[model samples]
Target chain A: MQPVYEVHKLSKYYGRIRALDHLDLALAPGKLVGLLGPNGSGKTTLIKIGAGLLTPDQGSVLIGGMAPGPATKAIVSYLPDRMALPTEMTTKDVVSMYSDFFADFDRVKAQEMLRDLHLSDSQRIGSMSKGTQEKVQLCLVMSRAAKLYLLDEPLGGVDPAAREYILSTILRNYSEDSAVLFSTHLISDIEKVLDEVAILRQGKLLLHDSVDHLRQEKGMSVDEFFKEVFRC
Target chain B: MNWNITAGRPVYVQLIEQLELAIVTGEYPPGSRIPAVRELAAEAGVNPNTMQRALQDLESRGLLQSQRTSGRIVSANQDTLHTLRVQRAEVYVADFLRQMHKLGYTQEETLELLQKATFPTVSNTKEES
Candidate 1:
């Protein structure tokens, strides 16, 4: 089967700074891969390239055998690391917008998840707490029945309780028919839910291996292995 | 059930051990159907694929059986269940002995300590006379 997301010798640059340097990675369907890297390591760059928001300077990124384009964009669900939703929009309005934009969007699932979180339809995005906004974004992102999900820092800035809720939501929504590549710094918190990890260093692919394989081979959890690899 | 996954160890290995414990303790009794992989994975807060791996491992060990119509079920064989229970207990026994050895307790000393101990109470009430 074709990989849900594939990158081959992908390189991107910001002027002289190398954002992605000869990086190669592939995500298979039915897997939740954690993309790990420290500051300026090109995690967001890689995600944006996969989301078709940015073009690579060299090499290629293919979403389900096609390059990231209008075709790939139709089947890709992206959640930017920062707040990207219109603040003036109410929760109900955002749900309606997603439903209108994505043919695969499940409005009922999004509304049910929002209700479960006690986020009312009338609540405006700008008025909600930072954590609530993150939850709202996640609810919409996961509600889509996309082929591949590119989530940048989905767990950032959320409290521990909210983090658990977010993780559970991800687990519940994940299916063997789709793939999710999520980038985050909270490794230990999200470690258990990941099938594999792709670690990057200075825009280079450091390592990509199954989480259990890493633990069995290195005799440490993925978080520990990640720390040992990137330790100062 | 509380998964109690720890760092350093492989999560799926922990999952396998916990699922084995659940089977041996009758939490998932003999011949009883188990929840779907997604449901169990969500409950444990781990990936569905990892949970599927753990369940498949149990199936390989004869502790679980997957049926075409009823989903996965705990093994109905009493002998297999009993042996599994004994094996799990022996692991704890071996660990206890190893710890006692680290503390410089001889086998005889450890045996005597076991004799004087009352489990479930978790307190050493034997008076030194």
Candidate 2:
């Protein structure tokens, strides 16, 4: 099967600083891949490239065999690290907007998830707390039956219970024909749920392997192995 | 079943171990249909793909069988179950013997210690029975 997302010798620079340095990564469908790295290791940059928010300085990224463009965007569901929803819009409005923007959006599933999260449809985005907004955004993103999911920092700033809820939601939406690339710093919480992990260091692809193979080879949890690899 | 997945090992390997334990203990009795992969994955709080891999491994081992009508059922073969039980026991006994060796106790000494040891709860259960 072709990789749902592919990057080859990808590089990006911010003036003089290199955000990504010749990174090569490919994500197969049916796998939940954890994009792990310390801050400034180019995790967000990589994800942004995949989401087509920013073009890479060099190399290529393919989403479903096409470059990140209108065609790929139609099939990619992205949850940005920060809140992108307008504060004035109510949850219902956002659901409608998403449904209009993406044909694959599942409004019913999104509403169901919002209700389960105790987020009323009438609640305005701006009035809700940061964590709630993130949850809402995640609900909207995961509710889409996209071919690829690019979730950047989905676990950031959420309480432990919310984190558990988010993980469960991801697991529940998992499909063999699609893939989820979740980038976050919280390795311990999500490592067990990942099929594979791709670790970056200093804008380089440090390692990528199945979680179990990593553990069996390193004799340590993904968290411990990451710490060991990134230890200063 | 309470699925406890610890760190430092492969998730599927742990799932296989736990699922085997569930089967051998009759928690998933022989010939009983098992839960769907998604259900098991959600219950264990692990990835569905990982759970499916573990289940496939068990199926290949003859501990589980897939029927056209039923999704997956625990193997009803007593011989297979007995062999698996004996295999698990041998692993435990090997580990015990290795530990005794590390403590400078010979096999005879370990057996003697085992014979001499008594558990109040086990003794009470025996008396009650």
Candidate 3:
């Protein structure tokens, strides 16, 4: 089977800074992979490239066996690090927009999730708390039956309870034939949910392996290993 | 059921242990159809692939049986389940004995304590304290 996401000799640079240096990564279907790194470690850069928001300077990035393009974008649901929804739009309006734009969007599922999260459909995005807005964004992205989910910092800036909800929602909503790639520095919180982990440092891919294998081989949790590897 | 998945241990191993316990305890009763891998993974908050590995391990051990159309089901063999239960209990007993030994208790003392714990009525006066 083709990998859900694949990057081959991918390189990207920002002026004098190297954002990603010949990075090679692949995410297979039916796996939840943790893309782990500290700040400015090119995690966001790699996500952007996979999401087709930024084109790589060299090499190739593929989503579901195809290069990043409109076709791939249709099958990839990306939740960026920031709030990208229109603040003035009501929650229901946003759902409608997604339904209109993405053929794969399931409005019923989105509305059900919103209800479960206690989000009023008529509430304006601008009026909701940052965490709530993030929830809405997540609902929108996950409601789609996409083949690949690129979640960048989905757990950032949220309370622990909300983080748990988001993680479960991602797990429950994503299709089994698809894959989810989530990047975060909160290793301890997310490690239990991860099947594989890809560790990045200074624009370089440091390690990528099954989480269970890492623990068995190192005799330490992912968080501990991460601290040891990136210790100052 | 709430599974306590501790860090520093391989999650797939923990997952297998937990699932086995559930099976032996009848949380997933004998001959009952188990939930699909993805559903269980989501409920346990682990990855689908990890859950699949754990389930496959159980299938290999004959604790679970999978059919092409109906998915996975717990083993209906009463003999296998009884043996599994005894084996699991032995593990606990061994661990308890090790702990007692660490506390400087002799094997005889440990057996006496176990006897008292098992037959509380006989040691009710001591337990009152």
Candidate 4:
């Protein structure tokens, strides 16, 4: 399989602090890889690089054999942990903006998803609760038929029911041809859906393998292996 | 099917090994219905994904069969189960015999210990200990 996202000796710095150090990764296509790490482990940094939202100071990053550019961004869909929607805009307006910006954005699907969510098109984002706004954000991201899906802390800080809804929506909207990279610390809940995983620690790659293969090789639970390998 | 357990190395293989035992020991006897993913997950207190993976692994090995209506079931033919049991028994017996040798016990003594320890007729099994 061709590596969809390839990086070699990738490094990033924010002023004096080294965010990512000599990171090397080659991701195969058709995978839902969990990026596992605690806070400040560069999970967010790596995701930002992948989403083309941030640039690496050193080394090269490629998406489908191309540098992170407009073409790459067109095929990648990103859903940040926090809601960034304009509070003044209505749900329909958000859909329209996404449709205008991304050619791959399917407005019909977006409208259908909004209908399924039972949220009225006239509902202003500011009028809805934070969790409901998250649902709207999720609906917008999933509306695009992109090759790569970067979901950063999608379930973070959400309530239980919202968490469930978000997870199910993610699963339901996933396409077999596309790859979804979800970065979060909620390993226990999402580990099942993950076909593969890349565990990051202290801004470095620790382990990357199929969930099934890892279990077969380690002969322990992923949770246990994680504890042992990352013992503090 | 869903499992709640964290699926990973050695653990997934261990679950597979255990399921194989059940198949061989008639706990999940040949031609008998096997537990659904949720049922097995709850029984094991594992994530339903783990059970689904285990079932998938079993199906791939051809030791278990799956149907749309009945879900997963034990394979009617016991050939695969029988071979697996023999393979595992060899390793376990080898380990037991090696441990006995390390403890300065002879083969005869090891057999005697096995005979006494696992004797099925010993209904009050752990009481003697």
For model 3, what is the error of residue A26's alpha carbon versus the real structure, in angstroms, after optimal superposition?
Answer: 2.2
Which residue pairs clash within candidate 2? none
Per-residue error (Å), model 3, residue A130: 0.4
Expressed as tens digits, the lDDT of each residue in A1-232 for candidate 3 is 8999999889999998999999999998878899999898999999999899999999988898898899999999999999999999999999999999899999999998889889999999999999899999999999999999999999998888778888888877756689899999899988888888999988889999998888889989999999998898
Query: Alpha-carbon error at A196 in model 2, in Å?
Result: 1.8
- Fraction of the true interface contacts (Cα pairs closer than 8 Å across chains) found in each model: 0.82, 0.64, 0.69, 0.10
TM-score of each: 0.92, 0.87, 0.93, 0.67
| Residue clash pairs of candidate 1 | none
Q: Candidate 1 regions off by >4 Å?
A: B104-116, B119-129
RMSD values for the candidates in order, in angstroms, are 3.7, 3.5, 3.2, 8.3
Over 4 Å off in model 4, which ranges?
B1-129
Q: In model 2 chain B, which range of ten residues has the least summed lDDT?
A: B117-126
DockQ score, prediction 1: 0.68
lDDT of 4 by residue, B1-129 (tens): 222343443345566777877777678788888876655644554434555777899899888898989788888485676788888899898998888899999988877877788555555655765
Q: Which stretches of candidate 2 lie over 4 Å from their true place?
A: B68-70, B86-129
lDDT at A139, model 4: 85
Q: Which candidate tops TM-score?
A: 3
Tens digit of lDDT per residue, candidate 1, span B2-72?
77887766778899999988888889999789998887888899989989999999999888899988689
Per residue, candidate 2 scores C-alpha lDDT tens digits across B1-129 of: 998998766788899989988898799999999988877887788989899999999999999998877689998488888887888889889998998899999888988999999756877888988
